[model samples]
Target: MDLTTYAILLAGALAGGFVSGLSGFGTAVMALGIWLYILPPAIAVPLVLICSVSSQISTLPSMWKVLDFKLAGPFVAGGLVGMPIGALLVARADPQNFKLSVGVMLLVFPTALYFIRKPMAFRFGGRPADAAIGFAGGILGGLAGLSGPLPTLWASIRGWTKDQRRGVFQIFNGSVLGAALILQIASGFVKWDVFWLAMLALPGTLIGARLGMRTYHALNDRNFYDVVLALLFLSGIGLVWSSIAPR
Candidate 1:
């Protein structure tokens, strides 16, 4: 590949890893948004999947104690069913339209959440509701490499404590992203270019994740959330611009 591709991969990896390490998700939101500027969705999606796994693993030790298997189970189960369908759709999807749709979601989802601020709490907290959201997340994960939005929103709506929210987000994303990587491999999407890109990205993922975790420990909950929203809004704008710009 050319220097441009290499530069994009490295830059995306570093930024994505830092965001995900700090927030328990948003690796794809940051990475894929930038990657889509140069790489097609097929390549960009799988690359994010691989790097997401790296980020998750690096930070696993920090959040290990807080994980609640019971709380994360329903979402994991639903994602198992939804991911393959999304992968199939990815294979057939129109590249420009898919990129545009993802860009729109990136822009709209964060903006809506920012404006809604302190949404009415969901009282039920039912397994079924969690599962439904997970299913949506899985489909998005499979299609555009974005599975964290629904779960993140749900966790916020539930008003979970920081540890509680981290537990759910990390576990759910770890499971789904791992599965997505495997599916991509089976579908012949993980080739040499992706492998080399991933290799070059490893250090950035490691370094950024370490820094992010430190930041996560220092920030207050409200401030952390604000930072995440700002990042999402910016990433969304990047994707939108990439979708419309000339190749």
Candidate 2:
């Protein structure tokens, strides 16, 4: 790998880990949006998973008390059920189309949520809705190393408190993404090339996570959401345009 590749890897890992630290989810979306422009989906997907897992390890423990395992259980189960199907799809997908789809995924969700003046907290969905969202998150997670957006969006719409949202998606993502990584291994996507790249990214991930956690404390709730959505929106546009541009 070239120095550029190494630099991009560290950059993505740092930014993604920072977001994950602040919001308790989003490691993959942030990272994959950057990586897909340079790396193939097969390599990028599992690499994002590794970075996601590391960010989780770095951030989860300090906030563990706020997490409610029971609250996250259904979502995790649903994600487990949906992961295999997503994993199956990637091997057959056109790489460009896969990137396009991920770009669209990144683009659409943030746009929709940006307009909300306050947490919507729709009354209808409840636990069943949560599970369904988790199932979808699993598919995305497996397919594009993105397991957080749907669940995170849903939680935000539900008007969950910061801790509540963090607790659920953080645990949900960790469980689902962990499973996705194992699936990648079994499917032969976890090679030494990706492994070494992940190793190179470890310091960046940890440092970013630490910095993000500190920033999370300093920023008020609204500021945090604004920054998160803004980054996603811009990255989404970049990924989409890249995927669709003529070679």
Query: Candidate 1 residues 66-134, lDDT tens each?
Result: 889898999888887888888889878887776677678767877877787774467585889899999
In candidate 1, stretches whose alpha carbon ends up further than 4 angstroms from where it belongs are 1-4
lDDT of 2 by residue, 55-158 (tens): 88888778888988888988998999998888888888786776677678767888888887765767577788889999998998888777887787677677
Residue-pair clashes per candidate:
0, 0
Full-model lDDT, candidate 2: 0.81
Instruction: Give lDDT: candidate 1, residue 221.
Output: 67
Please state the error at residue 9 of candidate 1 in Å: 1.9
Model 2: residue 142 alpha-carbon error in angstroms: 1.1
> Superposing every Cα of model 1 onto the true structure, what RMSD results?
1.8
TM-score of 2: 0.92
lDDT of each: 0.82, 0.81
